[model samples]
Target chain A: MTSSKILPAMPLLAAGLVATPALAASVTITIPQVKVAEYHRPYVAGWLEPVGGGSARTVFVWYDVKKGGREPGTKWLADLRSWWRKGGNTMKLPANGVSGATRAPGSYTVPIPANLPAGQYVFKVEAARETGGRELVSVPFSVPAKGGSASGKTELGTITIR
Target chain B: MRFRTVLIAAAAASSALATPAMAHRQWLLPSTTTLAGTSEYVTVDAAVSNDLFYPDHVALDPAAVKVWAPDGSEGKVENPSKGRYRGTFDVAIDKPGTWKIGMERSMIGGTFKLNGEQWRVGGRRPPMAPGAARPSGAAPAGAAPAGAAPARAPGAPGSAGGQAGGQPMRMVASVAEIPAGATEVKLTESLSTYAIYVSADAPTKGVLTPTGKGLEFDPVTHPDALVSDEEAQFRFLVDGKPAAGVKVTLVPGGKKYREAEHAQELTTGADGMVRVKWPVAGMYWMSATTEDAKPSDKRASARRMTFGSTLEVVAP
Candidate 1:
């Protein structure tokens, strides 16, 4: 719905939306053990959202990796609210380097294509369990940037981006 | 990869069920919707109450709650504890913009039968979250609250069946989807979301960006300036525009169980906005719904789209 008041729009203090990579930057995201009774492997989605406002590019998704049939975990990707809203709704699954099976509570890394340009960008990771709890974490960084680390106290653990 | 695409298409087939719906009423009631200081924090009470505004349902933990700050970072609730009727936690607003806090997207689903029997629960857990009150109706007689000790046995309403103490909806798990002669009845997939806005200052952006993936309410007023004494308008946008003919509901909170008993229903205007007000502010929620012209491709008997949100109206 459009607002008619028509005031000068406030600029959105953009999240860490940033750059293109010159080489494949290997980033590791860790999923920590939550120690809950109903512990289900989380459906994870990570991507880079441009701070200047453009479509978000998919980084990777982790789900029930073993299922190859019709009723795979693919059905619930939308449960990852933030990612699904931005692009998961129309995303094609099993992107060669961007999709993989759900991992254990350990560190996993993916090679991010290095050709992306240098700029500020937000690296987003969202996780949702089968029992209905969900969480999202975004790390603001710049391309051709230094590596840093952040963690989600609830759903995820240390994330190291170079 | 082609095989994965087929599997994804299959999942996309049922993704319609993931669309937003009024599966349950989750309220994110905050002590105040407007915070003036960057270091100040507001207390929020989140709950899944059957009686509406009453904290008699399940309790949620602070860790399960998430807060997206105005600057696009995750905000955590501090000192989360179970209150008498709701889950209480504190959020610190370090920026001067709109912050989003609520329970993660939760789904409650089960079978509905033609035999006049039905069952459901809050979120995905069969047992209510720890420290919340027990289920009050006849259903609790069969199973114990989940996560609780096996204080009792499982059986239908006083039957002497063996106890499955921690499973609250044991019987509910058995109802078959569309049992014989149940053409009119069907399996239900209910999705729920609870988000409350805290405006530390005038919010010009990000307060009402409709995801368009589900039923969503966008505020017409500057979220930082919402006042309980005045009526405000919220728009129910479907497909990113004003949705006409949608049902908008406002239930003011004060007395226990009074909200459900005295809820008001209004239809959206030609512009898809519903004007709502609070007589006295406490913790209030607004929910809206719309029906599609055709059944979902899944051929479910009835298809509906729902949107719900928690509103913390403050005094002038």
Candidate 2:
């Protein structure tokens, strides 16, 4: 959810608390185009794992949330094996400001959480495609980081953290 | 038939034989290699066919198959059924780590000489007639003949150590059964291992530990977490030691749909490691065989060991 939309709905006090920071951290993810007989949009999960040792924090989950059926696309969320093991299994569905629908093959830039304490951290992004493949890439950076980038060979493309 | 044509074309790169259908390729294919839930089930298909992963020749025996849980305990095969072409079974994975499922069989059989006579001791199959169809209900399905390649044990019963063409033979189980004072006797021990790995939540190490016997697969890269883009390193061990110069053959699945086998033949290095860079993402069958004089038993002079597994690799 964009801050402009939420800003108008919140009261004066809550709006001040939820206001976007001047220099918010952002991540740009590129979903690559895969050639195959059967290609389904990859389910992607982004999270942060402490470099030293701590619980993982989910940043975003991109999937077919509104997929029509008794069983939604959430059933396949576990296909993102790495993220599910790290922290996804504990998260509730349709988390506000973090859950969204799947996207096409292209680049997307989204804001990252700015509340992390000053310390080393590793940002992880995992994508899994039905009848295709799975790929996970990690980028290490410190709180108030300037930037970092990593690339995936198959299911995902280049990922940049700012 | 069209299938025969494809098989011949696919096998051309590997063998010089005009009709390569006589030799069977055995494999066990799991439904999924990695899963997420607490208690998920994985279905597996077993067969010995001309084409890899295509079940057309014979079904494997479920009795010979075993499952090892992620915790290193024996698991159960929930439902098993043998069809005319393949065998199917389901394993309930209730743990979080990886599980190993497949078959391991060993037998002691070889040529023995006694009083100027050479006798074949293992089970034998009557060479199938050219273009013969599936045999009727005479032989039991998936029963390994007593004294042959345990990997081929699921084959139908045939002449047991019986003379095929004026060769005197005796069907016996062990070398001890041979008469005493047998001169110039040579015996061989054959061991075969076939397996597949499936992970529930994450890949673990408990089931991947080497037994240090026969042929062992020690993967530097986890078997269940392999990706086609990166090279995977695996070590082969013979009698708990590095098996250098061992030939490893890796063939991708879906031979029925392709013209070439696309098989990669790699030899183990001094550390018994072979690096595999897969050409594509899908299921693959890998096998390695070695023959040495290190027999576990004194009765056997030579030992033959084979290790095979079906692996699924992801895109990245």
User: lDDT of each model, Cα atoms only?
Assistant: 0.59, 0.73
Worst 10 residues of 2 chain A by lDDT: A1-10
lDDT of 2 at B163: 34
lDDT of 1 at B179: 23
Q: Per-residue alpha-carbon lDDT of model 2 for B134-217, expressed as tens digits? A: 423222222424344322322222223323335433333445445454556677777778889998765788987888888888
* Model 1 root mean square deviation, Cα atoms: 22.1
Q: Which 10-residue span in candidate 1 chain A carries the lowest summed lDDT? A: A1-10
Give one clash count per candidate, in the order shown. Answer: 19, 1
Residue B63 error for model 2, in Å? 1.1
Residues B190-299, model 1: lDDT tens digits: 33345678865445356457776545677686444556777887787766778888887667676563533566788998898877766775556676777653332353
Q: Per-residue CA lDDT of candidate 2, range A67-134, in tens? A: 74545676688788778767676666678888888877888776677788878888899999989888
TM-score of decoy 2: 0.70
Best candidate, DockQ: 2
